[model samples]
Target: MARSKPATLKDVAALANVSRATAARALNSYGYVGDETAQKVQAAAGKLGYRGNRLAQALRSGQLPIVGCILGDIQNPFFARIAHDIEVLARECGYNLVIGSSEEELGQEVSLLASLRSLSIRGFIVAPTSADNNAHLQGLIAENVPLILIDRVAEGVDCDSVVVDNEGGAHKAVEYLIAMGHRRIGLLQDDMRIFTSRERMTGYRTALGAAGIAPDERMIAVSQSTVEHAVDATIRLFSQKTPPTALFTVDSLMTQGALLAFRSMGISIPHNVSLIGFDDFNLATFTDPQITVVSQPVSEIGRAAARLLFDRLSGKTDAPQKLRFETKLIVRGSVSRRG
Candidate 1:
């Protein structure tokens, strides 16, 4: 069925027996209008379901001095930190930061970009869903939009990016487990869509290779994209004939899921299953035996990304900048030395 056209200001005005300008003034409370006329216009608008377009109004006034921070997951504290930093920094430079979470979806990403572009968003910091953009990102580049990618970088798109050293962090964590005499170390990771996940997996493989430890296929748990999936993966890993003595998770949320699964299954940490999770969070130390994790500088990544965005907006750097922050291993009673 063909959808009916949206009601406009003119439609509301006609129903109220008033000029469009009078209807606009009454609806927006911009200028004086008689109480009776305002009520009539309001009633007409309500009946027709008319709503003024704020984006269009902003676009008409002038180029909006706003920066948009688009993220993959809103629930992740990592993204929340980045958004906070970007908003703080952008506001300092006389710009408002608008945030939109794409929920790690390609269609949502494209729609948000299109909508924000229409509003003349001055800059964009996006943790893209996938590297393949179908030319949507390339179009943004061609349009000369100031863009900075945070946490993830696209395949063919050449733009500014601020990311943590995923491989280095993973290697550091896994190597420490090996030093503690854990030979059967398991790698629990998400789907290799995002570059960060892939990099962490690479680091896992690199660490095992360098240590002369043979990679065991059964010990690896993958296809974990959500917390529930990660919980299931942990259960599957432990259900195996010969489970790994120590486990390394790729990200914070998944690590939490693993911890929960362990608790539910009555698997004691550092006793029955030594563990190392990625991205240290508030709950790390609150755990029974505290979690040892590979900690990335969340604040650093956000500030660096905002700086890159400001630089681009200010025409300071025409060339793209890829800044990789260092990650550290924080030992906090999570992994035990194998006897």
Candidate 2:
């Protein structure tokens, strides 16, 4: 079989019956092309399956034309969606995304970051593994790398960050349950070592304090990012002497665990135990009672983080920014009053 030639700018121009400069003007939005002409050029480009050579362009401009995105875990729906949005926005901005996932392992994250540096990717959007990895992050900053932390922020590591307000989101979720008259609420937290987990736990505690409900250590369970661990934790929480009336899970895995435990134990949702979770998932709406959750702007956060990194690479040297987006509690069938 004969190999196909990659479509070029010339192919698009030739198919559009216009000069190369005119086609470039239309495609690059450089100005002076009529609407009809622009449409024709775009149609021809589409027909020819034309794509600009971003690498070559970047070489000419002395930049990589690629953004490095380091995700905490690709298995999580939250991170997967963020990666998809980052790629979409990077393409829209005339750039490409090089994605990597750490799976919550420290050494692997450092290795991937170092490789990206060796590949000359000076711009990054990362959801770091732990706050303990400050030195590794500081090295990137010292190298003048434009870094934006997403979802999880490293402690003592100064850089641009885009995150949903974890504490505030947790507080709202808990408060929603409280208003429904559930005094005994359980918390299923991610590994306590993770920054978001710690912040969320703090939020949960703060909400209990405000509600005049004493915090119960026995009602809280912490686990790694595994369904098995989460399920075990949920079981422990529910098996306590004074079982909680409702459960608040911090992440998608924990939510699944809590739900699975409910199913296995023959406990009906919102009747035996109400549930609320962070980071909405597709299955959240389709379950027996649609899960009530605090919805975060995952795609928006991803795009904003990428934009921040791009701005830094473009020589915008204002102080590092910390962007905190709000989360909203989506009341659904899963949460109800304790009768």
Candidate 3:
């Protein structure tokens, strides 16, 4: 069987008894055309089932009805929520959303951005993998592309961003643990190249310094932002002869990993080792002792970033908006008072 060819604009023009230029103007409603001529073009198009090529039209106009999103890790619930919110807003604005995950790799991020740029996507929302090393992002700014940094920001990429107060949140969590008389504290964090990880580490160090506790390199563990890796890192941290009385995890997945590690090692939460994490997860309260965490405005971050991109798409040429939302410490049974 032979595949029938789809109808084209030239066919519609010939059937309408008009030039291709005139037919284009009539079908697109751009230039002035007589009512009878437009009706004729419409009739001809309907008869031939001439569905115009959207990609070809977009290339001619230099804009596509699509928004690209690159997140750190789609498997993480935090990123998943943000992606969902952005997709919802994109749909409401009559734009399709294309999503990719960097997986915390700078090379992958650069490659993904280049691929999306080749498609002439209208705008982008990205959670950069590295705080520095972002020449690819700078290229977008140079090209006047609509880009919004979400969750994380890159160095010298002066674009609109939506991030939470990571330093403040970490400081609050550590300070609370200190108030409970936990002098030896541990940190399970992502790679230091990540903006949020660096900020949270700073907060941890500053809080310890303020409490007259010397910073100990043995107390810190770096791991990729995944449950499996965090489990290994947690086990290593706790296996030391003298471990921290309390621990702080940078994200929810790591927090869950710590819980699993403790369970496997015959250690108990709040009784054996107090705990606090940066982001809240769905199962935070489902455990025996509810997990304490610093909760950010995950629901608002994505929607705000999407709105900023849409504004730029609509020709709003204002100053780049840097939105930083506050984080709240949700105290639960995970942390216990220690001497």
Candidate 4:
């Protein structure tokens, strides 16, 4: 069987007995066209089923009615919620959202941004994978693209951003652990190249130092922010003869991993070891002992970032707004007094 070719604007113009320019004007409704000519163009387009190339039109207009979001890992519930909220707001603003997960890879982040940029996307909201190495982000800034940094910020990329007080949140959790007399504390964290990870690590060390407990490298475990990787890292950290009495995981996925690792090792929460984590998850409260966590305003971060980007898109010329929300320690049954 022979395949039929799709109809084009030229075919519609020829069928309507009008010039291509006049047909385009009538179809697109941009310029003056007689009422009869407009109706003829519409009827011809309907007959031929001709659809304008939206991508080409967007290129000619110098911007697309779409927003791109690059998140670290969409599997993480925190990032998932943010993506959802951003999508809602983008839709309300008459723009579509396109999300891509970098999976904590800087190269992947760069590539995703480049791909979206090629489409002339109107703006971007990114959770940068690396704190420092972000020349690609800098390129966006230099080009005056509406870019909003979410969850994490890249160094030297002066643009709107929405982040939590990671250091303060970690400090509060670790300080509470120290106050409970847990001197041997463990820190399960992500790659230090990540902005949030570095800040949380600093808080962990600060709390330890404040309590006069020497920082022990043996007590720390570095893992990718995933349940499986964190499980292995937690096992390695606790395999030592002198394991930490309590653990602080940087994010909820790692918290879940630590719980699994403890269960496999026959370690009971708040009995054999106490635990606290950054970012709250659905399973945090459903466990045998509800997990304590440093809870950020996850629901607000995405909306705020989207608002900033839309504001820029709407021609707001204010200085780059750096919005930092605070985190609160939601204490549960996860931690117990050491002494």
Please identify model 1 stretches exceeding 4 Å from their true place.
1-62, 223-225
Clashes of 1: 0
The most accurate candidate by TM-score is 3
Give per-residue CA lDDT, model 2, range 290-338, as digits (tens).
9999989887987788778778877999998999999989988998887
Q: Supply candidate 2's per-residue lDDT for 236.
A: 84
Q: Where is model 4 more than 4 Å wrong at Cα? A: 1-7, 43-50
What lDDT does each candidate get? 0.87, 0.87, 0.94, 0.94
Model 4 lDDT per residue over 5-42, tens place: 67788999999999999999998899799999999999
Q: What is the lDDT of candidate 1?
A: 0.87
For model 4, give the 10-residue run with minimal summed lDDT. Answer: 1-10
Of 2 and 3, the candidate ahead on lDDT is 3
**Candidate ordering by TM-score (highest first):** 3, 4, 2, 1
In the range 124-241, model 3's lDDT, one tens digit per residue, is 9999999999999999999999999988888999999999999999999999999999998999999999999999999998899889999999999999888999999999999999
Tens digits of per-residue lDDT for model 1 on 178-209? 99999999888877777888899889989999
What is the Å distance of residue 56 in model 3 from its true position? 0.7
